[model samples]
Each structure stands twice: as structure tokens, then as C-alpha cells.
Target: MDPTLQELLDGIGPRLRRIRQDRRLRLEDVAEATGLSVSTLSRLESGKRRPTLDLLLPLAGVYRLALDHLIGAPPTGDPRAHLTPHRADTRTRLDAVVVPLTTYPGRLQVFKQILGPTSEPPVLVTHHGHAWFYVLAGRVRLLLGDTERLLQPGDTADFDAGEPHWFGPANDRPAEILHLFGPHGDRFTQPD
Candidate 1:
């Protein structure tokens, strides 16, 4: 194998171990779930044995993760974005189609969000970032702190995410919006 491939393979053991530990799963539990022996799983995590797809597929399925996620594969250098719209929650009719408008490791990230009517009341959450939201379609009900506002098509709002906030479709219809956020909690300064 090439040196680069060898290095990638060498890193898989630690990554697998970390993922298992992060999920708080015991080695025996993973073995039972993956139909792999505990000794085999231990050897795989400890780098005593090389990983094969036969071993990885079952482990990935048991961990509820993609094989690429398990191995920490580098992002493919494709320029175009592939957006897969999936159900965000089982209880609500909300479906999220997320498209990353920026590359990884960027200070600011942009997302195009589509939210369907929620079945439950919105739960406000506070975090440490600044966020901007621009409604593209339908009406969006934004709950920012004690203020409640309805945003129509082309409406925009920006605020510190430290404030209690939540948003969704104002009616039974779907709402599409653009969201931009600073990962490090940096505020977006408006242009003069």
C-alpha cells in the first residue's frame, strides 16, 4: 500500500475507539451488535488487526453511522453540493434540506433551510453564536426572547444566538429560509 493510504489506515483504529467511547458503548455490546467477537473488536480498535469492509460495515451499522464517518474520510473534492432532504423529526412534519454554502473550517457558515409546519410548540434554545435568517418563502414565526414576529418572503433578521430563540413556519405551510452563522460566536457587523 502507498504511504498515504497506510497512514490513513493506521488512524482508523484510534478513530473507531474514540467513536465507541463517545457513544458510551462497551466493547462487548458492540461485539454483540456487530456479530463480532469481543477479541476481534478489541484487536480492531487497538490496531492489532487491519480493518476490512466486512468488519467495518457491521460496525458502522451497529454504531448507527456511515462508514466514512467511522473512518473519518476527507471530504471529496467535488465542487457541487449534494443536498439530501431528510425528515428532521419523527413527531413533526418538518423536513430539512440542508446545503452547506461554505467549505469546512470556515469562520462563517451558511445554510438553506426548509421547515414544515411543526406539530409541537417551539422550544427556544440559546447558544454562543450570531445568526442571520432570511425568509425566502412562506411566513416564518420567529420567537426571539420575549418578542414574537412573523417574517414573510424576502424578510431578514440577524441577532446574537445567546438570546432565547426559535423559528418555524407560521402556518400549516412550509417555509424556506437562508441562515448564516459564525461558529465561534463572532457577531456579524452590518455594512455601512
Candidate 2:
């Protein structure tokens, strides 16, 4: 076997551990999210298990990184970002595709969300967080408490997640937005 290949393989375990810790995700959290057992993750992180595509793919998604980047592959000159897209579960029957934009551990989670038109009525829920979203395309309808507003491209909104709030497409077209949120009330921007 090539020495470089062996060295790369050997380094994977520490890399995985570092990334997981950097993301502030516990083994149980990763297990629950990835459906991988805690023991498996431990073994992988401890260098007792060999890395494979099936195992690394989900980890890459969880870490919001490209497989090559995650494995410490040599950098190509390509500046394009590789992101994984997943559906946003809005509790009710809502259509939203969430693509993470940033992966700063324990910091604000940034995502580009595309919310499709939903025939169902909006259902608001309360939580402990603050969310700021900027509309990038189409139209968005933000229902906050008893008030609702239709937002267009370039419009921005921020609110306490504790408030009963919900967002959806303003019309039949899907609405796209850049969403920034922190579940622990971490403010991304200062008040004007």
C-alpha cells in the first residue's frame, strides 16, 4: 500500500472526532441523527474502524462538508461550494428545502431555504431562539402572533422564536430565503 494512502486513512479517525467535537455534537446526538450506533462512532473516532463511503457520507452531511474536504483531500482550484440539501420538517405538512450555508460550531446556523407552496394553513409553534431571515426570491408570508405580512425579495425579518410564528410561500410559487438562527438567543446582528 502507498505510504501516503495509509497515512491519510490513519488520520481519518482523529479528523472525524475533531469535526464532531467542533460541531458540539455528542455521540448520542450523532447516533440519533445518523442512525449509527454510539459504539460504531466511537470505534470510528478511535481508529479501530475503517472509513467507508456509506459511513462517511452521512458524517459529511452532518458536518456540512464535502467528502473530499472532510477526508483532507488535496485542494482543487475549484471555488464552488459543495453543500448537502435536506427537507425542513416544519411540523405541519410544509414544503421546505434547507441547504446549510455555514458550519461554524455552536454559532448561528445559516441556511438557504426554499419553501414551496402549501395548501395547509400555517401552524405556529414557540421555541427558545431568535431567527433572522432575508428573502432572496419570490414572496414569503410571515405569520407572527396575530399579525401577518407578505415579504418580497430583499425584505428581511427577525423575531423571537418564542413568539408563535410560521413562514410559508406567499403564493403558489416557492419562496427562497437566507435564514440565520441561534436556538439559544444568540443575536446575529445588533439592533439598528
Candidate 3:
């Protein structure tokens, strides 16, 4: 086995023992719950036995944790933001998410907005915040009540959510934009 891989596997045994002790559960109790032999559990926890799916599955259930959480795997180098995306409507490819949900109010909430060509008529929604958006690549057609304009790449726009508005891709193409939503009472204003 590779040195790093061997070290990683070796560390899990001690972690398992620590978690079991922290939970104040005895080997016999865990064995009875998981239907695994107490001796086998002890050997596995003591690093005398190599960990396998058979051992890990029952152990994860006993500890009330996912297999990945129990093993402590390293994170993948994904460039995508950590935001959990949600679709507003299938007709309009409006993908959005609130960043750092527990963050303090008034701080900027970042979002990556992707709108498809079919996304239109903006279905103006009311919310308690202001928003500023910058087009990253494609064009975003903004409909702020009577005002309508096409924002091209590198263009930015800001507006109050209280104002009825709608937005979608211009020229029937997909659009990507970065939005910074502000807290209540902070009205977004465009640079004149």
C-alpha cells in the first residue's frame, strides 16, 4: 500500500474509537446493534483489522453519520461556488441560491444567475432586498416596469426589488450574470 493511503486508513481506527468513547457506548452494545462480533469491532477499532465496506457500513449507522463523513475524505478541487442551486421555474432557467445562509444581514449575498432563451416576461417577484447584477458573458434584457434595456457583456444594473421588474436573455441566447443582493432598505442604484 502507498504510504499516504496506509496512513489515512490507519488514522480512521483511532477516530472511530474516540467517537465510540465520546458517545459512551460499549463494544457489546454496538455489536448487538450492528449484529457484528464484539471482538471484530474491537480489533477494527484498535487497527488490528483492516477496514472494509462490511465494517464501515454498520459503523456509520451506529454513529449516525454518512460514510464520507466517517472517512474524512479530502475535498475535490471544484471551482463552482458552494451555493446550492434551486430552480425557480422550468420554463425559465433561473438558477439561484443564497450564499452563506447564516451570514449577518446587510452583507452582500452572491449568486450566479443563468437564464435561458425561453425565460421571458420576468414574472416580477417582490422581496425585501435590493440587487445589483453584472453580465458575465451574454446579454440580459431587463424590464423594470415601463423601462426596458438590453445589458450586454461587462454591463451592470441595479434596482430595488419593490419595483416590478422582469429579466431574461436577450437575442434568444443564454445569459450568465453575477448578482449581489443587499439587505432591506438598501436601494440599488445605477451609476449615472
Candidate 4:
């Protein structure tokens, strides 16, 4: 086996023993819960026996931990999604940066949008989704289903994307907002 791999495997015994001790469990207790013999459990913990899935799985269940946790798996890398900010429009001075906030592919997506001065008028368009926007800085102009509203900093709006809606900087100034969109008409409900 490769040295790194061997080192990882060697550490498993000590980790297993530590976790068992941390839980104030003895080898006999673990054996009783995992249906493993006390001697087998002890040998595994003492590195006399190599750890295997058959052994680790039952022990993990008894310890209420994931298999990786039992083995002390190293992190693959940072779990956070890398934020890539992109301009919404390049031809116009109406600068807008859209940064995706969600990592997984799903019906509900989130974005942090920053809009600069817009010389053109707001063009309303309709689509199939539910949208919620929270203004974080400056002011925003929201046109939804024939109604128009000016949202200031800290203001929020939730509406069906199927309705004709448009939003941008309220005036010739910059604005930042958090936008949550559900492509399949998913609604955002506050947890009870």
C-alpha cells in the first residue's frame, strides 16, 4: 500500500479507541451493541486486527456516527461553493453583478445582485417561478403585476415570477439585493 494510505489506515485504530473511550464505552459494551466479540473489538482497537467495513459499519451505528467519522477521514477540500460574480449586461453602463449563493442544483436558487445606474426604463417580463427579493443597500424599483413599488434598504418583497415583474436601481444609484428564485414555483415559508 502507498505510505499515505498506510498512515491513514494505521490511524483508524487509535481513533476508534478514542471515540469509544469518549463515549465512556468499554470493549464489551461495544461488542454487545455491534454483535462483535469482545476480543475482536479489542484487537481492532489495539491495531492487532485490520479495520474493515464489516467491522466499522456496526461500530459506527452503535456510536451514532458516520463511517468516515469513525475513521477520521481527512477533508477533501473546502465545502463552500466558490462565488463567481458576473456582469448581467456588458454593453450598457447599467452595471449589474450577479453572484450565485446556492451550491447544489435545485428548483430553489439564490443570488446576490448588485445594480448600478440604469439609463433605460424598467422592462417587465414574466416567467415561471416564485421570487423573493430583499434590498440590502440603496433603493430598488419593483414592478409586479401592474403594480409598482419602491423598496428601500431592509425592505423585502415576495411575488410569483409568473407575474410581469421587473426590478433595478430605483434611481441613478447603486443598489444591492438578495434574490431567491424557485424555478418550479417553490414558495419560501418561514419555519414554524
Clash tally, candidates in order? 0, 0, 0, 0
lDDT of each: 0.84, 0.90, 0.77, 0.87
Return the top candidate by lDDT: 2
Candidate 4 CA-lDDT value: 0.87
Per-residue CA lDDT of model 4 for 54-170, tens digit only, reads 999999899999887789887565567668998886333357999988765666888999998778877778888899989999999888877999999999999998888888898
TM-score to true structure, per model? 0.56, 0.59, 0.51, 0.56
Best by TM-score: 2
lDDT of 3 by residue, 1-192 (tens): 888777889888888898889999999989998999999999998999999999999999989988867877555564555566665553333544323322334666777777767733456655667878889878888988789999999999888877777777886777888877787746565499
* Residue range 1-192, candidate 2, lDDT tens digits: 999889999999999999999889999999988889999999999999999988999988888899998989766665454488999788756899999887666778889999999899889888888999999999999999999999999999999999999998999999999999997997766789
Q: Candidate 4: worst 10 consecutive residues by lDDT? A: 86-95
lDDT of 2: 0.90
Model 1 stretches astray by more than 4 angstroms: 1-75, 78-80, 86-95
Please give the range of 10 consecutive residues that has the lowest summed lDDT in model 2.
73-82
Ranking by lDDT: 2, 4, 1, 3
